[model samples]
Target: MLPWLLCALLGVLVLALLGKVCALTRSMEEICDQLADRLAGDTNNLLTLSTRDPHARRLAARLNVQLRLLRQQRRRYLNGDRELKEAVTNLSHDLRTPLTALCGYLDLLDRQETSPAVARYLDQIRSRAEAMKALTEEIFRYSLLAARESWDWEDVTLNQVLEESLLAHYGALTQRGITPQLDLTEVPVHRRLDRKAVSRVLANLLSNALKYSAGDLRVALTPAGEITFSNTAPGLTPVMVGRLFDRFYTVETGRTATGLGLAIAKLLTEAMGGTIQADYRGETLTLTLRFPPAEEKAAPRAVPGGGGVE
Candidate 1:
């Protein structure tokens, strides 16, 4: 009697175990179906395959991390592509304006009857052509500055460069009747910068000052080597000041300037490890260019002379 009872109990235990095994198998199948659906819908999905197993959970976590990285990379790629397209469009439009102007000027110069008036017209055409050429060169320089590549730096004298730039623009300043007050110190200050880049920046600033300033223009170089160019022009509003360094932003009067001068100046200054800022105070527009301090090992001695525009 005892043996028979034990056999019945063992058979009942075996049946219960079999039932649990079958239930687990069904659960696994459902989990697999769900996983397959998710994978088919989106390869980027992070959900794990259906299973009551620890291994699936670990795999899903690892896969989620990889998916996140891939998504970030994809987003960056899309953004870069969009920016490239926009840059190309802007380049095309800017180039078209100058090229069209050149074509029209050439056509005018090719006409019959070369009278004095015709000669004057030809001179005007030539001037416009030169302006267009300068515009193209500036655009190219701006593009180069905008690129992510680095530039070669050399030790250059800031005071000397400033003097040379001012001298070069002396004729234009005289023609425009704008007197430049130079407050330069005789101290020779050395800075690690690209010479060409610094010259371009000064040229742009001086050109803009001559073009826009209706009154006195003051360029002061401090003992600490902070150079400020201030012109007595109409005060700019806060909004205009905010966008003053922006590309293609002309003033309220719709000036004929290409509006890239200040923007390029700011960019090159920064690239050469310097800083630039624009401020409007008391009926004057001031643009400041600050260079990094000279290295301690360098010897600086003489105080520079004061020169005014003739």
Candidate 2:
């Protein structure tokens, strides 16, 4: 009778322990869901546990404190970023008026040319002014796009976009005595992307090649929707390639560039559920960009529906 009674008591204890374990598990799951929501969104909600477990309550209290701190830091970052973008936009706007005036005066001076030396000096000044203007415009566009919270997303034929971008950069490539080798797959790789953003990304990559290529360029597109821009850039190193996508990163000789091209491309690519990478080996620099196919999964867009990237 004593052994039988002891068995019954043990069984009841086991049942209670099992119930407590299940409750704790449910509380942890709830905490995870709430944490994920808070991280992905701007919410002030804290973890709400249904279980009365003391351990679970303590964990929730700790997490709540962390969440509040996290929110404070996030708010500060957003505010700082907004201010920086506005500063960039305003500076670019202010510089444009003076730049236009400077270019006009240079043009006027060119028309009434004096000595050969003066003409040469004028040419140098004009070239420098043009370079500065291009840099300013690029910065302005990057600033606006960086602050962009929306994008036009639609079904885009990757092959067509690649071809168009190539054609557009043909003049610049040929002028540099570089004829790019092309190997594009005929299969139409389709993606839901911002056409303008993708085009801008291509333009930046090509422009990067123009600056760094050692007179050779090879472009290829795979059937699986991978586009690579390869160039024999003898001067580039693996270390340099690693930082290619960072904003305002430039090599010693490429000071004329604001180094925002690849940075903007990366920014836009990620925003569109795409990726961009750079690899350097044996004096060759290859830049690859990929976007998820539209058929695979639905991706968010700047607007619920639209197209293009910048």
What would the per-residue lDDT of candidate 1 be over residues 1-310, giving only the tens digit for each residue?
9999999999999999987677567656755665566544435665554455565567566656766787678768757855764584478557867677786767766686688987897778776776665566556555545643445467888899999999999988999887788899898887876788788889989987876687689999876768999987774675787787898786865345667789888777765557789888776888999886656323321111110110
Best by lDDT: 2
Task: List ranges where model 2 is wrong by over 4 Å.
Answer: 108-127, 295-310
Query: When superposed on Cα atoms, how far off is each prediction in RMSD?
Result: 14.6, 3.0
**Clashing residue pairs found in predicted model 1:** 186-303, 186-304
Q: Give the per-residue lDDT of model 2 (tens digit) for 53-73.
A: 999999999999999999999
Deviating ranges (above 4 Å) for candidate 1: 1-110, 113-137, 294-310
Q: How many clashes (backbone atoms < 3 Å, residues ≥3 apart in a chain or on different chains) does model 1 have?
A: 2
Model 1 local distance difference test score: 0.71
**Residue 121's lDDT in candidate 2:** 91
TM per prediction: 0.61, 0.89
